[model samples]
Target: MRSRSTLPCCITLLAFALPAQVINKPAQPNKFLEAVGRRAALLGREDGNFEAWVYPIKILRDFQLSVYIDNALEPTPLSGLAETVEVRPGHVTITHVTAAFTVRQTWVASLDKPAVEVLLDIDTSKPLKFRVSFIPEMKPMWPASFGGQSTGWNQKDGVLTFTEGMGRFRPVLGSPRFTRISEQIGHQLPDRTVMIEFEIDRSGRVPIVIAGSRSTYNEIIQDPDALVPAADTFYREFLNRTTSVQAAGLNPSYDWAKIAIEKGWACNDGVGCGLVAGWAPSGLSERPGFGWYFGGDTMMSAWAMQDYGDFAGARAALEFLLDRQRADGKVMHEWTQSSALLDWPKYPYGYYHADTTPLFLFTAARYVRQSGDRDFLQKHWAKLEQAYRFCLTMLDDDGLLSNQKGGAAAVETGALSGKVARDIYLQGVWLGGLAGFADLAGWRGNASLQSEAESRLARAREAIKPWFIQDKGIFAFAQLKDGSRYEANSGWQGFLIANGGIDRALAEKAAASLALPTLATPWGTRMFATDSPFYDPVGYNDGSVWPFVTAQTTLALFRHGQAAAGYRYIYGMAQATGLSGAGFISEYFSGDRFAEGPRAVPHQLFSSVALVHPLISGMLGLDGDAMAGRLTIHPQIPCSLGPVRFERYRVGDAWVSGAIRPAKPTSTVDIEVQGPTLKVVKQPAPCIDLQEVKPLTPGQRGQ
Candidate 1:
């Protein structure tokens, strides 16, 4: 939870503040090949440029075969592999294959394109087997020398070799043989991309003979007469084994969510880390370089663990945050290389913005509930206490948490400059955290803390009302101080409402007002209003429809009893991003009319976690009453998704297994309540009082 005073300079310079035109311009279509599940179609070539829409996914590996004639007898330069060939509308003609092969030449394609189909018509009857050699994209000026040393490359005979120290190259070839090849290719930094070369032998054995990069010194000799086979074993294996989720057909948002999760795991687990932008390491590290602020990684990891019931992963992430808590109960914005607290020059060491603590608290509470590990709470109570105290201290004289620092931008530096205001998003986090705390406290028999948390939550709601309500609708983004408004139609605002911070009436108003045709793209809700000055379909936080935002908003809609609307949004987002073999989700999509965008950036983790909401809230209809350790099971399956079944593990060792099948307009849901099973009562009878739902402690069995 290390907070920084200045927003990461890299984020501003590299991510946000780039020129609008450059950011908004259509992403190069060829880049889509790098993504995993992209469905690339051979859209008729237009004016020499191949046009295609790539369905996004996390790519494990890719290979290409290039065929061309050597026109010049003199040795031609084999440089700039990316720029050498022109991809014409109908077909890409390879003009050269270097000096190695005179009549027939072969090369592996870069993983940057989504789907590539070779147009060559070679005779199948002949023994002249086409060899496709796969090689990682190598750029000049790479294999940088660090620690004042010359990092050189060596090729003895036909074996190309490059060496580096720990925190260097680690190849992930998706197989055991590739691991050895990856070792030969220089060491890889967590965030940096590295290339590996695999040769297809004449006997059709695609053994990766060498997998190292060429040194920048140009001292290493190129391999001549290298054998390349047509069949790429790794890619074929990946394509053959990976199966996409069935939900992908009916829901684009969920599909994207699945893809994002897969990619995040792939990158984090060293499967395909260098491809995606967000999840890839910022530097070399044994652990995936997950940022600490707002417990973003913790929340995402929790979402990822939902399906498999990976309580250990959920616990480890929670522990990571708890271990970093400051004495004053605040989480830091960022951590140093040694895992020490990042001390921002301007901000107090322990001072924090509002969201970090609350997110952590909620996530921690969820872990405890799912695992039924009271011991963990006992061990981390002190840290939780400090966090709660910090949250309570943030409340202003008016009951709402005050942005003592300059809001989100200042949480890092701890400086209170510029606009000294509160934001609705932060408030939502605070209230949500408080709600989680209230639930946890009630479960633990801490009546005092629970009551106090309830009072604080009530005040927060009261305070938020005036600022968001305008023209009988909820404002998109709101400034806390004096109730001024900014960004009238924001998906974030919808998120807060969907999460239960806003009242039902207000939630409905916000949903109705924001669901405009212009603002709601085919993928999901746009990040910004269509009329806003900053709206750009491709720009991050501008108009790009992020699956993460869509997922949260859809969950919020379900919370407000607008389940149909929630289902529609999730369905649309999933459909827009077609499923890939990797089963991961894309980070974002074009908010403009185009169904797709540039696909270079692969799967992300947070986007994938968003997919779980529909499974939990819509398909299973599992709603937890945290205080009572009780869950209400009401299945509301969409018609298109005919039959669905799942098992959900809940608190107190209770398990809820259920199936939902279509019954004309309505669906019939049958749930088998296991563990300390509760009596099944159909809805429309009077709502059950909280006390009536008995709380089950650990080891309790249902009759």
Candidate 2:
């Protein structure tokens, strides 16, 4: 049998060898035309921006478009005055209509280049001029700063080039039909913006190319008519590379989530390459909202990427983080795209999070399990050991992982006050990492290493009971520096259910607490129960409903055999996909209502996991041990989802095609496999074992 590591090469070879018709077709985006005011824009009118795939790409956050009649009138806002908008798979079209003329503009971020292309078609009786404008902010995203940044613009070779900060980023805007090119330089980068104009006649099409470099922009405008179709094809093929879910209400958002994940894969010139956390307009902030490489977010989002057939994407992300893993084994918390331009490491924010290390171990193990990449483990075994060893140094007196020693945790700045000695959330992740490390050790045939991990795993299991506030029927949110418990009904309980080795009864009890009004909301599970004194509906970690957190709780519920409850949360979070953006999910939402939180990102990379992970892992109950050539299919889907057909679901090197038909007592499951032979098991999904359910040690029982 071929190892999953070789699947990517084989798939690429097969793609070239096989006929095109046999390949899966990309999902067709529904044609949508709805009138929306400027406030209803996904990224907000003032802060909205678009980005394209470019090594040294321009951040199009403040970029705008307008039109002028006869080249004599004032440039009218076309985007802000948009009467209807149509968002397709890889492009967005905004339409503006008036008593005299109707204008439709389509924007596409070039799939293979660092250029953003726009196709403008006008239906005006009078001669019109279309304009593209933006102030070049030559600064990379936040946390990485460059001083003396100034904006300069020059027109040469019929293209207008905008330069920023010691000539680091130079972007050009040009069109074959350009009427005029102009710019205004400022003392600093913020005070300047550039404009490109195009002459338009009846139903005339103009292509405007904005690129990271002049040559690239010139090459694009030379054959501007071909950019949009090329971009559309690129996005389609990219989506077709992953699994497709044909469940009635689920496919749209599922496809959207796939796009969001694919878009998250970014590469900076000299900084590094990996999945970014999320992207929003930078606005007044130096950085776009979380628009940089994030180790923790990348690893967590990789779960969903692997769940679908994007194992290559998952592997790429894992390798990116592994390459940058700290010398002492702590995974990075954040890496700004402009790190190469600044003294990034000198800052303390990179390795500030304690949970990122364990998440690395967990995600590495998961990638190997799901992708059957034993060679990856063999190659990076020493680094994995270092990560696990680093985790051990953070243990508190009770044997649970301590946030104080490691770094910032889930509740970094809010919800919990004072120095936290330990938290059940971090401990649960630690338990999961320990289990994962043991698996890695066993895979490497290192019994001693596995034994050591197992030992700590057992000790942590015994120590966790003390944090269970028995009266509240909930796990303590944190153990402060004084070793006193801070009890609160929190969504973090789901972490224990999903990863911590809590007993089935205890997991069920904790999952039940999530059903209470204080913790459960119409949108999803709240970070903290509303009744808690510290709860804040919009607080970063206080009471917001993070879709990723909801995912943990949903999976926990399913792991504890609470499928109905899990489905409810899944359905609720899925609705946000339709609400916030066409197919995008926001970072978090208000715990008290269906609205997204004030600063929630329109498209968060990890937010997709809330749908993809649970829908595949929980509802479909598809777990893979690709290393063992085994896959377990234990569907716990509710009838409410109706019949579901999931195809091209990747399990290591193998592909799974499954159908779930609701029946009286249970759903009938039919699964078909391709690529490699697999031992398909039909049974209940696996859960964490509570250290053989043994009683606690005598010294610890009374605590």
TM of each candidate vs. truth: 0.63, 0.87
Task: Name model 2 segments beyond 4 Å from true.
Answer: 1-61, 69-73, 145-158, 181-196, 684-703
Worst 10-residue lDDT window for candidate 1 reads 14-23
Backbone N/Cα/C clashes per model:
52, 2
Over 446-524, each residue of candidate 2 has an lDDT whose tens digit, in order, gives 9999999999888888888767766777888887788667788889878777887776677777878877777886557
lDDT (tens digit, per residue) of candidate 1 on 299-396: 65564454434455556556655666677787644332212121332444223345677666776776676566687787877787678888777777
Model number with the top lDDT: 2
| CA lDDT of each prediction against the hidden true structure | 0.44, 0.70
Runs off by more than 4 Å, candidate 1: 1-145, 152-201, 209-248, 251-294, 332-354, 403-406, 409-420, 480-483, 532-534, 578-582, 595-600, 624-629, 639-641, 647-654, 662-666, 673-703
- Please report how far candidate 1 places residue 106 from its true position, in Å: 16
